[model samples]
Target: MSPVFAALKERHPNLRPQFYMSDCADAFWNSWRAVFEVEGVTRLYCIWHVWRAWNAHIMKVVDDARRSQLREMLLKLTQASTPHAFYSLYNTYAEIMNSKEYMLKDQNKKPRSLANTSQKNMSSTTVANCGLVSAAWAQISLPTCT
Candidate 1:
């Protein structure tokens, strides 16, 4: 991939690329992180893939009866109008996880690992770098007449 990209860059110095990929593996993300940083490329995560990962994670931790409702709320966060709103919802979710009712049901199970996975996956760096909160909504503001 690097050799191919290097050749292209040599042929077209003005050319810039945007790379979109799934969060299927940490290796995949790490491999491109350095390449994108050095080449000044925009790295975007596929929303469909993101939803797949989110759904998988939620299914493991959330109750079956409430999974559908919780999944809907999780999806809505992706459509948040602002980063603050996104984080606010995230914080609310965190608080819910810590509540007495939640703790009793959790029963010292695997919720901690679940929370860690969600936190790392939703890190500020990932959100900002992928422009999930801003670039997404910004597209709607473009004038259709233009």
Candidate 2:
């Protein structure tokens, strides 16, 4: 265990550790997974980084109106409490993008289409950690005695 955890455990013996890691290269994830596996620590990718990646994708969209609409939907998807709700919003966005009514082009001025399976290939991380820390952090009344 790290010294930080040791100190915190001294005060709160029942505390549990939840590790949040950004999705990294295969080699880095392999090494990290091995170490954390032995320690029995649960790990998840930070949702903040996931949201940033989504924003980057939105910026690549050529049409201002479509970009704004997608951004709005992205915010709602991130805020969804259940996986069903998230996917519902995601599918809605995908349908709009793929529809003939919503003619769109890429930043390169070439025509583009939204592929249903393409989103899976765009990011390295799938599982996102959103509420893992917030509730715990709110309850901790740590003294900033340093």
Candidate 3:
């Protein structure tokens, strides 16, 4: 717990420790609160458990099919050897609720992801974390390689 939380509770009598937090019922809610919604600001949690809760079931059905088709590409992306190549690979949806035929139509345009790239698009800090360079942003450097 942050000192700010302790202080806020002192200021507001209604704000119980539990009120300021999500209980076992509001599971993701608590994780969200602890991370992003401090003082009403929130950031998405990037934890695997959360993802498994959200997407694991959706992806299980087509897992073998995808592995046969693009396992190698998926492997490199997982290993992060070619961070940029991830966008060109297959995306495994943890919450695959739609039919395979329906999903595949949109999959080609988006490409499969080893990551949730949409989150990065929502935050610049994420892009930098991934070491992405802008296509339009030119590089200016003096070559030093012998």
Best candidate, TM-score: 1
Q: TM-score for model 3? A: 0.28
Instruction: Give the Cα-based TM-score of candidate 2 against the true structure.
Output: 0.45
List the candidate 3 regions with Cα displacement exceeding 4 Å.
1-40, 67-124, 127-146
Q: What order do you get sorting by TM-score, best first?
A: 1, 2, 3
- Judged by lDDT against the true structure, how good is candidate 1? 0.47
Tens digit of per-residue lDDT, candidate 3, span 1-146: 44555565567745423112122123444553554435632223232432342244225334666644333432343334343443333133212223343123222121111223344343444433233212211121111111
For TM-score, candidate 1 versus 2, the one ahead is: 1
Instruction: List, in order, the clash count of every candidate structure.
Output: 0, 0, 12
How high is the CA lDDT of each candidate model?
0.47, 0.42, 0.32
TM-scores for all predictions = 0.52, 0.45, 0.28
In model 1, where do residues sit more than 4 Å from their true spots?
17-29, 33-42, 100-146
- Write model 1 residue lDDT over 68-130, tens digit each, in one string: 766676566555555677667656654655561322332212110011134435555454534
* lDDT comparison, 1 vs 3, better candidate: 1
List CA RMSD, all candidates: 12.1, 14.6, 14.4
